[model samples]
Target: MDIINEILSSNILPYVLLGYAISILVVVIMIVLENRNPLKTISWVLVLLLLPGLGFILYIFFGQNFRKEKIIARKGLRNHHRLNNLAYSQISQLTHGSLGDNETARQPTGIVRLLLNNSSSLVTTGNEVTFLNNGKDKFEALLRELKNARHFIHLEYYIFAEDRIGNEVKKILKEKASRGVEVRLIVDDVGSWELKRSFFEEMRNAGVEVYSFLQVRFPLLTSKVNYRNHRKIVVIDGHIGFIGGYNIADRYKEGDAKTYGIWRDTHIMIQGDAVNSLQSIFLTDWYFVSRTELTDPKYFPASQPVSNKVMQIVPSGPDSDWPAIMMGIFHTITSARDYLYIATPYFLPSESVLFALKTAALSGVDVRIIIPEKSDAFITLLCSRSYIREMLEAGVQIYFYQKGFLHAKTVVADDKISIVGSANMDFRSFEQNFEATAFIYDKGAAQEMKATFFKDQSDSEIILLPEWIDRPYIEKVKESFARLFSPLL
Candidate 1:
């Protein structure tokens, strides 16, 4: 008892106590001043209280809110207000003119208006959209487009692996740069951290301008680590563009045979005025990183209408005050009069999205969601299962793809509206990552997406409510525990 007393009263105890007190103080400050979601606040507090020393370190890296400061800086650099004014002017002209005459625009007007107003995503008419179902097709088409590049090539992705496919793409990029094509590439530092500086030296030596978004010097001590650039965009000479869930990696290609089997995904190739919007998004991000303004008319060359497909390139990120992509999806679900089909790798949605989906299902709308049977993140899978019962009970049909891992983020509503992008049906995509989706107002595009969803469904196993409820008790407990971390996940 004497020894215990002495140890408890040792000088080391005071330093330990001080450390814990500082952690507690930080927790209090976060709860009081961060203005985060109540659930997230509780989650962070719980992590801090439970993990003690390590929790505070995690909080320092992930919990600090630098969005407002970074957003203000980006706004000042990009002149966002001028872009907003231009978008608003375009919206006014479209609203008063013959935009409603097109059936594609007549439907989903509210969603279009909301994106235009909130995200400054101007609706562009006359776009041709082609769906690429897998990475094989996507990369093939991308390579062809790269081979034909003339003036400039811009590419951005969350993951640009230094693997087989990545090397091939790099070879093409180097060749293009060598031919005076002005190639530029941006990748997320954290996602592609495996890539060494030497991996990019060859490209740099060949005149390719490479930059990493929000590079982390110290991975465990940086606030920027939480926010990632998740968008995958490819623009060839400002006339052709590709955007969707694909990254430059062999794992995305079919026959790569990952642990989950074949990889299934979706991407879209765009030609016409919509490519200009995609290029603008790339330029905005480019300016943020490279600090070289690219507002010349050469990059925004006039595009003649190729098709009747109306498109709005809606970009969302932590930089924005509102979750624009989530809001657009919510509006799409609420406005659906016939049916809604969704395919995403992650299904952990926000409360508003969950409410919207449940409301839509209960309103007699045919709502269906497809998720992969085996996800890359096991914790996210566990948390996703926690919501399966609720969604099933609400009459929302849930299907788990069995043929392969489904990484496509797609939605087709009422056979007249479609969305394809990098933003998943999850809070991380909505609230943290820089994502972009193409709001396509065309029955042809919607039908193609719906057909793809059905094709994916042919290989999926539907989860019945009774069977989901009868899952093992241990699994239920695991799900409950995982759900507690859903906000943070």
Candidate 2:
């Protein structure tokens, strides 16, 4: 026993013990200071304990919680409190206004109230909403509106590739700028990493202002990588607005056989007071990137009532106290009476969302989710499978879209309410990235979206619980391992 002890207490044992001590210290610090999700905390602790060196590097790059710092700094620069108060006042007035008298408005009032109380999302009425499915229809309508831009055009996208579609849009912006119309564009630096400064030379020369959000510089690693602006927005003359999942890239459009096959997506075009809200979102992002506040009254022209559709623009990011879009989705799910339909490319959900979905399914509400069979991210695809068995056991029906990559982020409930926008049904979108979504409380719009969901379902293959359970042991192992790192993914 003495001989064994001497071997155990050798130099190697001391170094190993020291490494473990450091990892434990880091874990305690993270648990005490970060105050992140319990599952995420546990995951990080496991990573640190199991793989000390690589885990420390990963934590330094991705696991650090700098949301509080960013939120504080952002609020110091922008009048977020003032804007939030304005939105609250508008929501309060609308809640007590004549619109509340209608029975149509009564159904979604709880959701609207939840949004207002949590995120201060302003509810606007008399907006006309047109749902555009797939990129071809969306870009076609957008091009038509671009041609009709009388005053200004503002566009912001996560991915604005310098491809055929991107160059076409740039050409239109240059033409509009040459005609004395203001054209401003914002693209995410990380998402458009492949794009070069020379790609926008023509537009810049034509007087079109362009900027990249959170541009990364070499040798200075930062937390900006986690806080991306994932919103896709287009505002024309402050009267028409477009928001959804379609990015400014050729892959989103048809005929990109080499990249994505028949890219399926959804976007919404709005013509009413809601456009003002969309314009406000774009201008706020523009100010963040360019440091130029667009506060002119011309950008918020008086909007006439186009329809009786009630809409709210819900924007969420690391700047907020909590995940606004995720909470909105939760409220929408818990408020469902008849049916719920959801389609998203990513499927990883936070614990609260997963619980809500399981509870809803177990309560007899028809719950269905559609996801891509072959996702773009292999690890993400594997991680999504970990939750399938649980959800399936709870009576939730899962469909794997077989026709193409399903990139649409849409939710419709009870054929009366719908949410469509850039925020996917995943943790990255809900917690880390800046995202915008439109909550439409209109029976007609909801029915149309439900119909579209059914059409997509026709092309999807339902996953059976028995077959899923019978999947190979290796696949199950992969899924379990992938799920462990899903929080970071």
Candidate 1 residue-wise lDDT at 399: 99
lDDT of 1 by residue, 1-489 (tens): 987688688877788788779868867685769788887888888888888778888877777776676542556544455668878886886687645345444656678779988789878877899899988799999999999999999999999998888999999999989989999999999889999989778789999999998888765446788899999999888789999999988899853464888899999999988898888788888987888877676887888778888889998997776789999999999899899999999988998899999999999999999999998999999988888988988889999999879999999999888999999998889888899999998888899899999999999999999888887899999988898888888
lDDT of 2 by residue, 1-489 (tens): 987687597867788778768867866686657778888887887787778678777776667776676532345334455557777775776567644436435656777777877777777777899889978799999999999999999999999988899889888999999999999999988999999879767668989999888877744455666678899999999899999999998889873565557899999999998898887678778778777776777988998888888888988887677688999999888988799999999999999899999999999999999998987899999988888999999999999998889999999999888999999888899888889999998889999999999999999999999999998999999999989988887
Q: Candidate 2 at residue 271, lDDT? A: 93
Q: So what's the TM-score on candidate 1?
A: 0.95
Instruction: Give per-residue lDDT, candidate 2, residue 66.
Output: 66
C-alpha lDDT of candidate 1 relative to the true structure: 0.87
Worst 10 residues of 1 by lDDT: 70-79
